[model samples]
Structures are given as structure tokens and as C-alpha cells.
Target chain A: MANMAEAVNVEALGAKQRRRFPHINWLALAMIMPSVIALLLIGLYPLLFAVSLSFQRFLLNRPQNNGMFVGFENYAAVLNDPLFWSSLGRTMTMLVIVLIVQIVAGIGIALLIDSSRWRVLNWTVKTALVIPIAMTPAVVGLLGVLIFNRDFGLMNYLLGLVGIEKINWLGDPTMAMVAIIITDIWQWTPFAALIMLSSLAIVPHEMVEAARLDTKSPWMIFRHVKLPYLMPGITAFMIIRTADVLKLFDMPFTLTRGGPGVSTELISLYVQRMGFRIFDMGVASAQAVLLLILCIVLARAYIHFFYRTPEAE
Target chain B: MAQAQNLQTNLLAQQARAIARRRSRIPASAWLQLVLLLLLLLFILTPFYWMVSTSLKEQNDTFAIPPKILFTPTLEHYNFVLFSPSAIVPTGLQNSLIVATFTTLLALLLGTPAAYILARFEFRGKRDLWFWFISNRFISPIVVALPFFLIARDLRMLNTPQALILIYLTFNIPLVVWLCLDQFRAIPRDLDEQAKVDGCNLFQSFWRINLPLAIPGVVVSAILCFIFSWNELLFALILNRSTGQTAPVQAANFMTGFGVKWGEMMATGTLIVLPVVLFAAIVSRHLARGLTMGAIK
Candidate 1:
């Protein structure tokens, strides 16, 4: 998108140079003004306000105190709180697990589809994969609840058929974490697959043939050839998936509600509970600012790596 | 020479097949792949199948162990979801439709002209202006939820679809701007110049010339905006606490209040998934492209 935009802008510049027809650049500004103003009011202003709120003591529970200048007190307090640290830790853990599983499973599916002999089979698999991608994450959470229902859920029933014991997928704290992870994997693996598949479609056949000519082992061929081609897609997947997982609210919110004593309390859910339910705006804002920083830093690093790596070329 | 060439070509063909065989490993790899693909499909689609099946099953059948793979399907849950006296589905659907439609329209209205300008004309700080508009997409909704709530409360727009529409514009406008910028850029500048030569001002030329060609982008953005609003939970959950709950929030409500109503929840889940899934299928490529922010081809 950026490439196309830049290309067009350059073309337009050339055209403008050729035919300087009374340029009204002000009209361009006028055209964009509404969006600019709306974004400032609704988007940028709220963010700045949130940052400002993070520095003040605006606790709803202690409404007797107004927005006093706490001056980093909320950050200090939040940093000291074990729950905040634990939730952040848990969120990081979830991010790693979900990202790793989704990318690996996604690449596997992509390779499987790429290697399919029949066109019909490939199309069917691709269509089936994307179905999960389109489903609402909240519904996916609810679906997790039903699927993990101990007595009647298909999970237990299928387990029974395989002579395994019934497990409390969501009731047990560890299993609850596992359940959310599973739900997230199910929901997003297809996204990874779709991206990898598209990228895989563009992997040069000549490179693959050359690799085949050089190596008899499939793993060697893949390592030397296909993996390099897939790196960009994988990196893009990682950046996007990691950023999203950090803000995971809907799935865990609906599935476990941070579950069985804060085990699944992701950062977003933790912040929401703090800000809304507990009405600790100061602490919540502090946590949110931290999350925003983390996301921005992570996205920036990945984007830099994505662009800087000559391997993508 | 012909015979020698034929022999060499045949030798290469056999060598190629041998390498292909080594890559494939087994002669029955196709069958093996088919079976595995079927299993993967089952893994992916069963949740949906279960969702739909549970929605259709009789209340008892939903819980039947060795779960009923086949049952006399019924619309009892659908009936309950749609027709129950306390049914929130109808209300939720209405709210979702209203909010999503207006949000899409508003985003398009506010985003299109900006996109056209970015596409056609050179300006100062154009890159910065474009970044400011589209970067809102990366801001987590949680970061803005409370401030927006406070803003809405101050403005007395809380618990209304309008609040959702306006707050949602934070991302929707960016999305529209980015998507439509690409679309507008794809149209040649010669057309605009020609239209100008024929006595159309910039706005007229844009309206009569550029806008019509960019309908597909507008439509795609509209669908995306609608889906985002429809599936949105956090803002709708927080902002519209009571009267204007969207379908996603309403579906979530079924899980918490009272004992869990499995059938009706599934019914609601099915309902929520159906429209978006249909929309995604109809424009699946566009949907994927949109998610990547048009970054990937």
C-alpha cells in the first residue's frame, strides 16, 4: 500500500510539473481537514489525555480526592503491585506461546497446501482454513466454553473415544490458561496459514528446483530454499500477532474472565478491570501507557527488522 | 541428433520424476495428504459444526454424551433467541446494523476526500498527515476506552449508537483513508487532468471522475467497517452498558447472567458468525488484504 501510494505521488508530481493548472493546494488541505480534526479529537487527544491521567490520582473509589498531581506515583504503585507484574508476565507468556504455535502451525498448513497435488483439494483446504479467521473472537471464546464443557463437550467425548480421561479444560487454572491458548491458536492459526500460503505462492519455483537438484533430503531443501522465502511472511505474522496478543481482551474476557484466580489475566483485561470495574483510572492509565510503549517498541523493532533485512529481497 | 536429444530429454524427465519422488517420499502421498487435510479440516470446522449443531439440537441432545453427531435438528434455540419476550438479539442486531452502517458511511465520507488529496496532489507534510490519520489503527482500543467514555459522558452521548459510531471513527477513518488512498492512486491522473480541461473543478472532477472508479475500495472499506463494528466487544461493552449493546456484547451477556444458556448462546454465536463469515467469503481476498493494511500482495 505504501509503495503504491508513493509511486502514485511521484507520478502525480511529474504530471503537475508538466501541466501547472492553477494548483489549489488549499483545496487538498480542505479535503483532508475533517478527517484530521476528527482524528485529533477522537484519537490523538484521548491518548494524550490518558497519558495525563496516568500521572494524576484520579481514583474513582477514592472520589474525595480530585485529580491531584500524583507525579509518577501511579507508575510507582503499579510497578510495585505484584498483580500488575504477574499479569504482564502472563501476557508475555501467552504472547510467546500463541505466536510460536500459530506461526509453526500456520507454516505447516501452508506447506501442506502448497504441496497438494490436486487443485480442488488445495482450494477446499484454503477455504476451510479461512473460516475460523472470520469468526468473532468473542464467539470463539464462547465456543471454547462449550467445547471444554466437561460432561457433554465434544472435547471430552472425543477424548473418551480415544480412551483418555476427561480434563477440566477451563476450571483448572493451568488448564484454563491452556484453554485460552488453544482457543487463540484455533482462531489465529488460519490467519498465519493464509499469510504464509500467499507468501508461499510467490516463492520462486526455480529456487525450489535448484535446491532439489542440490539436495536429496527434503529438510535440507526446505532449510536452504523455502524457509528463506517464507521469512518475511513469518516476520510480518510475528509482529502483527505479537502486537495483538498483548492486547488480548475479548477471548479471555469471554472464555475465562482471567479465570481461577488471575491466572489468565492478560494485560488488557487487567487494565480494563482496573480502569472500569475497580475505577482506578490512575493505575489503569499507567498500565495502559506501559502496554502502549511495549507494543510500539515491539512493532518498531519488527518493522525495522522487516525493512532492514536484505534477506527479504 | 534427434535421437540423442530425445534420449537426453527422456533421461532428464526420469531424473526429474525421481527427484519429485524423493521429495514426496511415498507413492501414496496424495492419499496421505488427503487424509491429513481432512483431519485438519475436521479440526478447523468442527467447532463451527458444533456451534451450529448445538444451536439446532434439542436442549437435552446438546449435553448427550458420545455427543449426537446426528439428531433431529430444531430451531428451538433460534426461536428463543429471536422470539423470546426478553430477547435482546433483535435489539442487538438493530444496534449493530445501525452503528455499523452509520460508522461505515461516516468513515467513508470523512476519509474519501482526504484519500483523494493524498492520491492526486502534492502537499506539505503529506507523509506526516497520512501517518497521523492511519496510525490510530495501532492504538489499542483499551487505551482509549475510558477517555472516550468520559468524553461521551461529558458530551451526553453515552449509551447511544452515535457514541459508538464516533469513537469507532478513530480506527474506521484511518482504515478508510488507507484503503481508499490506494484505490484512488490506482486511477490515472490523466483522467483528472482531462476532466479539468473539460471545465470541471477539482471537486467536480474528483466526484465525477475519481469517486466512481473508487467504488470497489469504498465498498470494501464499508464492509470492513461494518464487520469491525459488528464484532467489536470492548467499546460496545464499556460504552453502551445498557440499551445499545451490540450483538457481540449481547452474545457475551448470555455466558454470564443466570446459568449458562448453551443453546441460545450458540444460536447467538451462529448468528454473529454467519453474517461476517458470509461477508468474508464474498470478499475474502479483500478482507485478507485489508487486515494486512495492503502491505502484502
Candidate 2:
């Protein structure tokens, strides 16, 4: 019966489309043309250019040997480069840790706020959450520099109040990574919380009430009732955040500039160093292509596993 | 029988008293949750607070041990950043304004009609087109930054505001298209049909009937585009170094020089952040939808 109804609906929609508009919809085509052209020129062209550039020896500084078609050599070099591997390693480490921390803390805070009865408090918290998201990452990095300063920074000052000795946050290698992680968490955890809070707000009250009657435990209620509603939001967040973390440039760029000694260098910074600072466009383009492929594969995998259409629901 | 009646009456009174007590007192758990939320709010606001405080403090007071909670505020840093003869910030601000405003306007002009088409019409390759637009968001900016820089240099467009404006469209147009698609979808299809019966063509129906209704969503997306363009660092840093530096890049420039002018840098940071935070607060309710490309909402 369901399948038959859906078939009828589809047939009716098709018939209506045929009656109202032409099969080609010329007006629609015309309207979308400019944006399509712009996107192609600005978006797709640059990507294709980069891909083509990756297969050559394009040195910006030494324009003499540039544009020599060294097929696969650049990719091979990127693969062999230890800096490439280490930066990729650092990026993945940060991605895993940041995603985990943000998701857990974000949802936990959302649940806390959602469970509260005060309307004003919810509004205030949500409004406050927007500040971090609004902050420019580069400026945030500067703030991180100040907050993590070894001598007179706020982090150490606060620690001193509790009798803990000051720690060199950006000076030491391991500690610099930690400081970067903390700054990232501080800046973005609110994003997770706000998104999750919005998700939690839409949880079906009747279903939650039914679950409450079944068991007094909040844990069981959340597991059975709220988690399902929150899944799509979480999945969406993961897809977006994964892409973002993979390409993260601004905050770390300003905060540590990939180091006291290259310890904090992620893939994007590595690419920047190669392409701009070192003037090796070929290697950078190769790394960029690889990163692009990784993003597409991960996004596709996420949609395959977790994304559900309204029809599926 | 009399003793049984008295026992029942006593139980009723006890139940009433318990109800009254519960009504009079708040739950401890709720109090704890509220406290935690306030702490989270503080955590979210502290960096901003620090930025503003340091921006306003005298240079000596900025580095005070224990970080002075109370100090004489000064506008010297702000004056230096805004009015000094050699100041780059004012020019950066102007460039940022010009680029961001134009980017928002153009993205909307080009994106809205396409969004309406995608939303209301059924066409071949629509799904592919939509995906293509959205996937632009996921592409690491580094991929395009170098190529764009080379192209800009070749065309002599480097250090020009136009370069940043054109490059930002790669992301902003997609964002506008996605956000407005959701908005257009929410409007009833019957309105378009009504306009059609009233002798309106497709474009006229879209412009006259639907566009007004979708203004709020359009404004939200515009604000977002503006914020993204204004706060953008990498493209602005790369494409326009001297003549067309935006506020964020100017703020970043403070770090490159010797002795790091902390006060002036904080002031620049404050200027860069102020408008974005205000716009963000205004659009906070619609933000999750915007940030997630309307997927979650």
C-alpha cells in the first residue's frame, strides 16, 4: 500500500510538472547560468589547475625550470617526504582528539542546559556560545598566545592561584601542541554545544515522557529517546568538522606558525610552507590533491554510513 | 471504623504537606546544571573579554602580574591603531568593508535566483549541481590559494581588493545557495501557482511572491557571508598583502615585527572581532542551520 501510494504521488508530480512547465525549463536554466559559470571559473578551474600543476615541476621562485612535466614525481616526493608524513600524522591526531573532546563535552553541556527549566539561562548561554564561533581564528590564535604565555599569561596566573607552577605552553614542543588543542577546544566546543542543543530541543516530548515512565533513569531515557534524534545532527557535525579540521589553517597559523620547531605543523601549514614560503608549488599541489581526495572519501563514507533521507526515516 | 477514617485523613494531610514542600523548593540538580551552564558561558566569553580588556589597558597594565581585574582604561592603543599616520588598520578596515559588502551583494544576486530554481523546480542534474555547490565548502582553501595567487600575480590583480572579492565567491556563493534553498523550500508551492494564475511569469512570481517571504533567511545568509569574508585570513593574507590587507590580516601583521606590540595588536583584534560578534549574536538562532548548511535543522 505504501509503495503504491508513493508511485501515485510520483506520477501526479510528474504530470503536474509536464502541465505547468516545459520539459526543459529554460527559465530555470537561464537563472542558474551565471552562478554555474562563476563557480566553474573560480571553483572548479582552480582545482583542475592545481591538479595539472601537481604533475609538473613548478617552482615559483625558479621560474626557469617550472612547468616541466614530471609525471608522478611530485606525488612520489610528497609521499617520501618525512615532513609530509609527520604533518599528516599531527593533523590526524588533532582531528581525533578534538572531535572526541568537542562531541562529548558539547553534548554533555547541551544536555545540562536543555534539562534546565530557566528560559533566561538557556537564552543567555546560547547567545554567549555565538561569540567563540564569531571570532576570527587568527585573532583567536593571538588570544591563545596571550593566554598561554609562560610568564604573564592568564592560564598560568589562574594555575598559580591554585598553587600549580607555571608551564611553558608554546615554548616546549609537546606543550605547544597541547596549547593548540586547548585553544581549538575553547573556540569550537561551543559550536558543538549549540548545534546539539538545537537538536535536543526538537526531541519528541511524548516519546521522552513514555521512556521516563518505562524507567526513572535519565541515562536510559536519553539512550532510547534523545540519542536517535541527536544522531543526524551529530553525523552532520562530524562531516562538517572533519573537513574543517583537515583544512584548519588560521588559528595555528597565527598561534604557533607550526612551531617552536615544526612540532605543531599540520598538513595545511606544511602545504603553505612548501607552496609559499619554500616556493615549491608542485609538492604543495600534490599534497592539496591528496587532502582533497581524503575529504571526499571521508564525506562519502559518512553519508553512506550515517546519513538518512527523510524517506528512510 | 472510626480509627480507620482518622488514619486515612492523616495520610491525606501528609501528602498535601509533601506537595507544598516540593513546590516551594527548587531541585538541587537543576541548580547544579545552571551553575555549570554559567561556567560554560564564562569559558566562552573569557577570550573575548581578555581581548577587549587588553585592548583598553595601558601597555604596562596589560602585562601586570595577576592580570589586573581593575585598572585605568586607556584609548591610546585604539587611537594608535585607528589614527596613527603609519597605521594600516584603517585601510584594512575599508578594504574589508568593500570586499565583504560586494561579496555579500553579488553572492545574493547570483545565488538567490539559482536557489529558487533549485528549490521549486524539478530538473535533470539538479542533485549533481547541488552537491557540486556544497562540496566547494569542503575543499581546503590551500588547494586554491596558491593557484589563485599565481593567477592573480599573472593578471596583475595581486594586492587588489578585487582578487579577494572574486576568490571569496567560491565559498560564499555556495553558502548563499544552500541556506536560501532551505528557505525557499519552506515557502508553500501554492503561492507560486497563485502568482502564475494572476498572470505572473516564472521570474516575476519568484521576485514578487517568494522573495519577500524569504527575506529573513536571505538576510541571515548575507550576514554569514559578510562575516566569513570579513573574518577570512588566508586568502586576504595571500592575495592582498600590502594595498588590500583586511582587518584580520592587519591584526596578524602585528606579530611579524620585533617586540610584538601587544596593546596595539589587541586593539586591532578587538576591531576585527566587534562587528562579527554582534552579527553572530543577531543570527545565533539560525547559526546551526547556517553552519551545517541546513542539514541538521
By TM-score, the best candidate is: 2
Q: In terms of DockQ, which candidate is strongest?
A: 2
Docking model 1 quality class: acceptable
Model 2: colliding residue pairs:
none
In candidate 2, what are the lDDT values of residues B119-232, reduced to their tens digit?
Answer: 887666676787778778788999899888889999999999889889999999999998888889889999987897799999999899899999998999999999999989
TM-score of 2: 0.92
lDDT string, candidate 2, A42-148, tens digits = 99999999999999899988999899999999999999999999999999899899999999998998998888887898889889988988899999999989889
Clashing pairs in 1: none
Shift in Å, residue A176, candidate 1: 0.1
C-alpha lDDT of candidate 1 relative to the true structure: 0.83
Candidate 2 DockQ vs. native: 0.56
**Can you tell me which runs of candidate 2 are displaced by over 4 Å?**
A1-22, A302-313, B1-24
Which number leads on lDDT? 2
